[model samples]
Target chain A: MDRASRGLPLLISRLDKDYAGKAGPRPVLRGIDLEVEAGAFITLIGPSGCGKSTILRLVAGLDRDYSGSIRVGEAPIRGPDLSRGMLFQEHRLFPWLTVRQNVALGAFHCGLAPAAVDALVRELLERVGLAHAADLFPSQLSGGMAQRASIARTLAGQPRLLLLDEPFSALDAFNRLALQLELERLWQRTGITMILVSHDIEEAAYLSDRIVVLEADPGRIRTVVENPLPRPRDRVSPAFNAIKARLFEALHVDTGAPFAVPTDPAPEEAIP
Target chain B: MSMEVSSGGLAPPGAAEAPRAVPSRAGTLSHPANWRRAASHVASVVAPVALPLLLLGLVASAWEAMAVALHSPLVPHLPEIGKELARIFRGGHFFGEMAVTLLRVGAGFTIAFAVAVAAGIAMGRQKTVAHFLEPAIIVGLTVPGLVWALLCVIWFGIGLTGAAVAVALSIAPALLLNILQGVRAVDAELLEVAAMLRLPLRKRLACLWLPSLMPALLGGARLGLSLAWKVVVLVELFGLSSGIGYQLNSEFGAQNVAGVIAWTLGFAAVMGVLEYGVLAQLEHHLMRWRRTAQV
Candidate 1:
């Protein structure tokens, strides 16, 4: 990273989020503080309901109900900006729109000339391998292809910060692997800052520069592990497996254990 | 219904695989695949239509048999009704009455639709609006078409205004309820996606809310149009000088069973054309996106 780009980090300081319940305001996220360096890939991985997605929501500026100071570069994120692109797990493409039209919508607020928007859409579609399916609607596209188009749509705006909330968790294993590789290539090509929320530890290990493991029950960041793997990571490599194992450990998974049902002790016996 | 269209056994080869969109064809079916496609298309079309036509035939035959067995003046045979229908067609008296009734339904339904859509949006968006407006809709639902027609006759003085108002009142509540439910059911996730993408408000509303409201909109229209037809007939039967309903009432007063059956069948034919030919076509076109999703 260059000196100028190095200083500008995506920072979250003392972040907190709550949901209103019959009892009171129930806290979802508590005191989350993290910094993502510019042009870096970071993954937030945790079990369900651990506020992994909430953190992305805050950065994407969709949830202003939360208490947090989220700064991208120097400016605070008060609301969603064109430069921060978000891709949800469901793809969220408009059913009525063709793939090209859906991708073109990413530039809807850009006010670009028609020719330029079309050119950008074409280029992005080609990159995502969805150029042939341009005229097809979301309902027509396969799950993987739809997700690829969604990624193309997000990239068409040339966002500086990309937020992905389990963008490929819905896909089969093969498509998921292909998309992860494609994502890495895009990141390398654009140098856009990306923060992904995923449950798949292997996915996080494969794509991220740093993996932030989170724990549920009043969600908190358990630890952030630096990934020292080189580019175009070999998933079968010893180093990659080592990092994956460490991530599993950070998430408090019993990696060595096989499937089993625990037997309850006698009623009078003390519980471990 | 969509499932019947989508899940046919001869579902095209592409359907079993990636479900690539079938290119929309025009009149010139040049390719050989187009012929098989057309043949399969015919079979698919016939599958739905054959049963309904058969059912209609059975009902008509049963009614004819009942008329023959009873030999009653009240239940005229099919031939008597057919003869009366032919006479009415030749005289062209039915057309004028039909036109007047249709005009009233169109005007009344338009008014009801405009008001209900606006009100539904308001009710869905604001709890206070819903609280204030809900009781009126609930009470309106409970009030029958006859009562509304009678009340409207007193209020608007027994004419087009009275009939139209009655039809609108009878139909609006159901439309409003459907629309309110639709509005409330707009996907929060998609809205979040729109916001996160920084899509302009116009684009968001166009691509998200409008499309999301389609099922509700169509549901309301189908209900409203059918209800408007019924209410208008009741209103006209009670007091109007001219309409299909008035003609039916006159026929009933004179004990002309064949004339009543002819008018009823003729009116139903027009409604069938309007519903199956026009509204059904519109629904098919608008909901083409749903075809593959069902599969």
Candidate 2:
């Protein structure tokens, strides 16, 4: 509570979050110090239980248990606010709402007029290429399409920061690459500060400007590597391979993933 | 349907960026009028029904031939039942009794439906409330309908109130449990989304909760309807003042098998009409989104 950032843009000077008293004695996130400039694309990488999602949740004000402070421009985050947008791996579109109604909900609590919200909803629907399905319910959507609706709903509030928790980790190979590519273009166009949580080293390599790799158990940042790949990053390029290798090493995947090779195989066998 | 699938498919991050997204739902029927769509809807329904109708005809023929071979008065032909069914439509003293039974059942069922849905939604939304009240629901469900009718007679002293209460008590527990389970089974991620968006509570209930709970509600209604009929008849056979159940009891006492069979067929037809013409229509409208999920 003592530490305070004096109007110093989105500072996290020695941020520590713990959950020791809940059941057993343990902290979900401990001794985490990170900084992101305005409109930077930062990716958080980790193993399954590395608490990367916890870190993002903390920053988004969804979880308030912590030691060190997180100040978004001299203001401490206490609860979820309109300034932060979040998307999860499973698209959480409300089943009762049409695509339009679900997206419009983001603006429901705001002080905007109804017409403005309606116009914005239509504009967003068109942007997501779901203008025609705007009146359709979430159950009517395909998995990929539902995820798009989730992203559109997240962006509806025009939040200053977008926190994504493994948003594309559940998708098939084709959808994953397509969404990642779309994300790249969106990030370039929007210039919003983004903190993406992902387990896939290759995904972090291609999508992030700066990738922070984490190992589990204690959930500490193992490596903070700079992504040197050029824009419109080629996944097959040597530069991309080098970064992906570093991410793998940080995660201690020396013997390869417990299941099998995670890399794309061939055109027809790409799903494996 | 294709449009609905693709509309949700473009989850690629760029779809809502750079003012340029590939138009996936562009060519789909943007808004098919409810009336214009009814024609295709009827065709879809008829295509499936044509087979069942044929099967029913075959079954009726087999039953008639078997009855003839046996020369048993116990098994009557379909034509005799059809003639008796026409007689039912002519409106006799028995039909008046049936109308009274329908009215009583209708009142009891309506009361049960409203109370159960309300209680269920409240319990479903709050874990604390559900935990506290669940024991009472289990007790209600375990107790038999006839026992409740007996209790009602003891408590309310043998009138319409006693019979209706018996009907309500019999059906309410099933509906409550079914609706509660339905509500609880709703996806948690959707609630998280609702919380993040900060929707008005009413809109949250309508858009997120209601549609998800529809199947459970409909299931409860179906179960509750059958129970209503059974309980109403049981009450009449025992002590109800004037109803179809009393008529059945009298017929059974006199060993008029034809009269009993005719009433049973007539009641079965009523249930069939209600399910086919009413419940099916309601289910169709509520779960249209389910069709896309199937694809």
Query: Which candidate number would show the highest TM-score if scored against the true structure?
Result: 1
Cα lDDT of model 1 overall? 0.83
Tens digits of per-residue lDDT for model 1, A46-148: 8898998988888888878877688998899879887888899998988888999999988877889999999999988776767678898888788888888
What's every prediction's RMSD, in angstroms? 9.5, 8.8
Residues B80-199 of candidate 2: C-alpha lDDT, one tens digit per residue: 777766665575765687788888788888888889888998898788888888998999999999898778877887677887788899999999999988988988877766666766
**Cα lDDT of model 2 by residue, A115-183, tens digit:** 999998888777767776788777667676777788888888777778899998888776677777777
Model 1 clash pairs are none
Error of 1 at A211 (Å): 1.7
lDDT of each: 0.83, 0.76
Interface RMSD computed for candidate 2 is what?
A: 8.1
Worst lDDT window (10 residues) for model 1 chain A? A263-272
True contacts kept of 1: 0.41
What value does DockQ give for candidate 2? 0.23
Question: Could you tell me the TM-score of candidate 1?
Answer: 0.86
Docking quality class, candidate 1: acceptable
